[model samples]
Target: MTLKEIVDKLGATVGLGADKLDREEEYCFASDLMSDVLTLKDTPVLVTGLCNVQTIRTCDMANLEVVIFVRGKRPTEDMVELADENDMILICTPYSMFKTCGILYGAGMKPLY
Candidate 1:
């Protein structure tokens, strides 16, 4: 699914990188554990609730492009700045992590495992 589609479906707000919404992703990884996230190989959309600087840093290390913050978690300025520097897309969704995962999966987004 396109990042735009995910945003529309989840009624999420774009915190940054709106221009990059056209990016396509078939897989998604939902986790708050940064260590677990680092294990991902495919460049899937990261669905995480851990809205911290480390999240952005981990994405940078993993070279992931898009991140959806679930349960209405918003990014801090530092986090946004770091993500902006990395040219990554930041999305905020009001739904819980489980609902976010289910919605994306129901919409044909594959899971990492």
Candidate 2:
């Protein structure tokens, strides 16, 4: 599914990279553990509740293109700048991590496993 669709489904706000909302994403992995994030092979779209600069850094390192911040958490300005610099997309939703994952999964987003 497209990032646009995911955002719509999750009622998320685009904190950055709004122009790239049409980007297609077939897989996703939700986790708060940065170490686990690094272990993924494809680095699928990251659905995380960890809203920090390090989250952006980890995704950049892993080549994950998108991050969905759950529970309405917003990234700091520093995090936004870093993600923008890396051309990464950041999305925020008011739902819990579990709901975020479920909505995305129900929308046909595949899991890494």
- TM-score per prediction, in order, is 0.96, 0.97
Model 1 residue 41 distance off true place after TM-score fit, in angstroms: 1.9
What is the C-alpha lDDT profile of model 1 across 37-70, one tens digit per residue? 8888878889999999999999999999899999
lDDT of 2 by residue, 1-113 (tens): 99999999999999999999889999999999999998888968899889988999999899987999999999999999999889999999999999999988887999879
Off by over 4 Å in 2: none
Clashing pairs in 2: none
Q: Cα lDDT of model 1 overall?
A: 0.93
Worst 10-residue lDDT window for candidate 2 reads 38-47
In model 1, which range of ten residues has the least summed lDDT?
36-45
